[model samples]
Target: MTPLTGGVASDIASLKVGDARYCVKFALPKLKVAADWRAPRHRNAAEYAWLEVAARVVPESAVRLYGRSDSAHGFVMEFVTGAETYLWKTALLEGQPAKGEARAVGDMVGRIHAASAKPNFDRSFFWNRDDFRALRIEPYLSFTAEQHRHLAPQLHDLADMLYDSTQVLVHGDVSPKNILIRHGRPIILDAECATMGDASFDPSFCLNHLILKAVHLPAQRTALYDEVAQFWRAYAPHVSWEDASDLEARICRLLPALMLARVDGKSPVEYLGTPRREQVRKLALPLIGNPPATLSDFVQTLTSRLKELDAWQR
Candidate 1:
């Protein structure tokens, strides 16, 4: 078995049993570095549950879950191989341009939420607010607010909105690292943060990564911006909720807060320098203070800010 290093919440390894390779995972009771964080061990079960649900709703984008370990607290799934399969994060860092893959991400997320918006999906097993607070809210939002005391009210308000909303099923960690692309199709991986929550969290989380990536690889800013636009365009039509406009307004507010959190939070993006982080904050702070009327307006404003920074310059 070879250990994989991309994830932080779980123990993951690639194993070959006979001719088949499998990705095995074990959720830890506590995050390895921050033992005091109090992450739940049962997240393994939560992820497995999400895999089961997603496989039914969006099979093309979901990995097939094999089964749980006979004796251990873990599960097994197909280990996707070959050069065709690429981590979206690695592709961005290496300057590989996207070709409508972001749209696929948006489409799949919409499909899952559209199919699972019922009042009886048994979220009781994974109604894990404290777990989410410890791993995500505290370290990402609240801790960042502590670092910038002035932003506490904004951050806390956003956090309250997230915890209060329970409109649809959400795949919490929808960043590039969790998306795998093969032959132009996106396969989502890692659902430890999966639960019943605000549907906006999924796309907003993803857009945050794209914004950060634009800052990291300034030369690819235009391409990344187009990708973000593509995601929202493909995603919006599938939102069957009556209050789509309100949800989008919420996403616009949440998106910039998440962007700021990534820079000032516990797990700041590793590649962002002081200048890049400040550039993100320049856009993020204003949005958090007074958000745009729509997602399109947010994109337009973000694009303008990126251009002001001359992000396309070499």
Candidate 2:
């Protein structure tokens, strides 16, 4: 039999076993994607536990958890397969898949978030000194003096506020990259750093993460944000603009720090050259400051600037 080729992210290894193909996912602390810690480690057992619950709740949208083994950081599990979601969307945007498939991706997240609203388990993390220590303080100490001084203060305030927010299971991370367009719908994967905290945490991550990559390409950012935001808006209708307002406030405040967290956060992604990554990192320089007077003011200013720069990118 021929080796089974993958149709998703290359973070995993796969093989064809006789008449069957096994999809395996690998995760290590050293891979250094942002937000996880080194100590007790991300409830590897707990993550698996939550995976079980997530499977039960969002079966259609959740990846099947088969088995696991420990790695330098966490553990590996069976790979979720169908079609690589990020590639699917990108291909669709480039005019490959059907347009409806793109729209369905948005709705899929909304539904997932809805189910996550009442998580079967406890997964919230307090944005306290511990989280900061594991994520920012530790990773950042590796940077030069200027970068540390620049990032530390902002992370402090953002962590402080994040510590005081309401909890929810918002997929923790929801970039287009992590999504798989299996069977023509969105199936979210990578729940390792999945946390239960701050209702805005996940969606805010979705909004800022993959979408921010498009920031340097404002038209792309706007187009993507429109699709993404519409998905969230329609999916979580009960989630009022006021609710969004509050979360958006927190997201804006944390934007600069979050950018730094990418490079310094525990599970940081490799800084492969992408126009989005390079420019956003550069533009983030002046934004992650000490505490701003009010969240609203901070949000308004940052968003206006985000819009202006993104538009200029076009």
Candidate 3:
């Protein structure tokens, strides 16, 4: 078995049985971060169920589940590796941003949300919010609120709003690191935080990564910005369960908080240097205080600040 390295909340390894290769994942009670972060191991079951749901909605976009082990608190899935598949995060970090793949990801996520939000859809199995709160709300928003008392009210409000929302099934961790591209289609992994919650979290979670990647790789910012636009444009049309405008408003409000979370929350992005971290703070704080009402407005505000920072550095 070869252990996979990027995940924090679980132990992931590539295992081969005879000629078949499979991926095995076991939930960790305590996340592999420096912080004293922990969550229930039952999230492994939730992730397995989430993959099943995604496969039903968008078969091509979800990893094929092989089997699950209740006692072991882990599951086996198709080990997807070939010349055709590559980690999206690694590609973006290496400056290989693909607009097509971004659009595909948006489409896949949107389809899953739309399908799950239907009146006849059965999502009771994912009704529990404990895992989502333990993994996402507390660490990403509530914890950050504790660190920045001045932003506590707004951060806490966002946390409450997200925790209380029950409109659709959320993947909960849609960052680039959990995505793999195979022949231009996105294969989503890591749904340990999946739950019936705010749909805004998925897109906001994803865009946060793209925005941070741009911040880290300034030379690739323009391309990444286009990728961001493609993703939102593709995803927005599927917001049929609620007012698309209202959802976008929530996303705009939530985006900056997520941005701040990456730098100050329990799971800070590892690639950013100290200067870039400060830049994230500068960009995220004001926006969190007075969030934009639209995604375009948020992007505009972000781009303007990025340009100003670039000029100041010169």
Candidate 4:
């Protein structure tokens, strides 16, 4: 058995069964990290159920499930390997630019959310928000608020706004680490945080990674911004909201809050230095206090603010 790294939510190991290989995933009641974070064991069941639903919607982007073990609270799925396939985050970290690739991933996510939004789509199993709170809110948002006492009220309000919405399906953790690129498209993994909630969460969550990577690798800032723009361009057309402007506004508002969370939250990015972390805090505080009017506006404001702060030099 080979243990996989880069994930803290589950116990994942690779195994070879006969001539084929599979990935076994087990959801623990608490994060393996040194924290009080805990969630129900059945969240693994929710992930398995989501995979089954996602496969039917976008088989190309879904990882195939092999089986499950109730006693272990785990499941087995196809192991994506070979020279042609690699983790998207690994590729990005190695300086491989993702221009068109980001748009394809956005299109795929948009299609999944769009198809699942159909009137007859059954979303009964994903209605639970306990896992979302334990895994996302408490650790990422609420915990971050605790670190910055002054921002507690706004952060709490934002957390409430997230939980109050249940309009579209949300993939709570859309980080690059969970995406594997095979051929020309992205195959999404780790659906334990999947739920029926605001569709904006998925895109905003993904965008947060792009922004953070730009922060980590200052030289790639322009390329990363282009990718974010490309992703929004490809995905926005598929959103079927009555008030597109309002939803975009919400996305803009959430982006800074999430960006701040990555630096101050329970799971801060490992690559960031002390100076970079401070840069993130400085950039986020103002944006959270005054949200931008549009995604483009947010991007522009972020770029200008970072420039004014000399974030790249730091």
Sort by lDDT, best first: 3, 4, 1, 2
Q: Which candidate wins on lDDT?
A: 3
Candidate 2 regions with alpha-carbon error over 4 angstroms: 1-11, 26-29, 32-42, 69-79, 82-151, 163-166, 216-221, 238-242, 263-278, 281-314
- lDDT of all the models against the reference? 0.82, 0.50, 0.91, 0.83
Model 4, position 58, has a per-residue lDDT of 77
Model 4 residue 292 distance off true place after TM-score fit, in angstroms: 0.5
In candidate 3, position 95 carries an lDDT of 90
Candidate 4 residue pairs in backbone clash: none
lDDT of 4 by residue, 1-314 (tens): 89988788899999997898999999978787766778888888778887887788777777879888878899999998877788888877777867477898888888878877889888887886777888887888899899888888888988888787777777788778998888777888888887887777888899989888887787889998888989888888888854667878888888888989988888888888998888888888988889987888888987888887774565
Better of 2 and 4 by lDDT: 4
> What are the root-mean-square deviations of the candidates from the true structure over C-alphas?
2.3, 6.0, 1.0, 1.5
Expressed as tens digits, the lDDT of each residue in 210-291 for candidate 3 is 9999899989988888888899899989989988888888888999999999999999999999989999999999999899
Of candidate 1, the 10-residue stretch with the lowest lDDT total is 29-38
Candidate 4 deviant stretches above 4 angstroms: 311-314
Tens-place lDDT per residue, model 2, 1-314, is: 22233321123556566666665544434433333334334434445555665577667766666676554334444555543444443542343424444355556545545555554534444223343334333553333223566565555655555545445554444655666676666666655544445555555455555444445344454455455445555545545323655555565555556665564444344432465555556555666654243433544554676767657778
Best by TM-score: 3
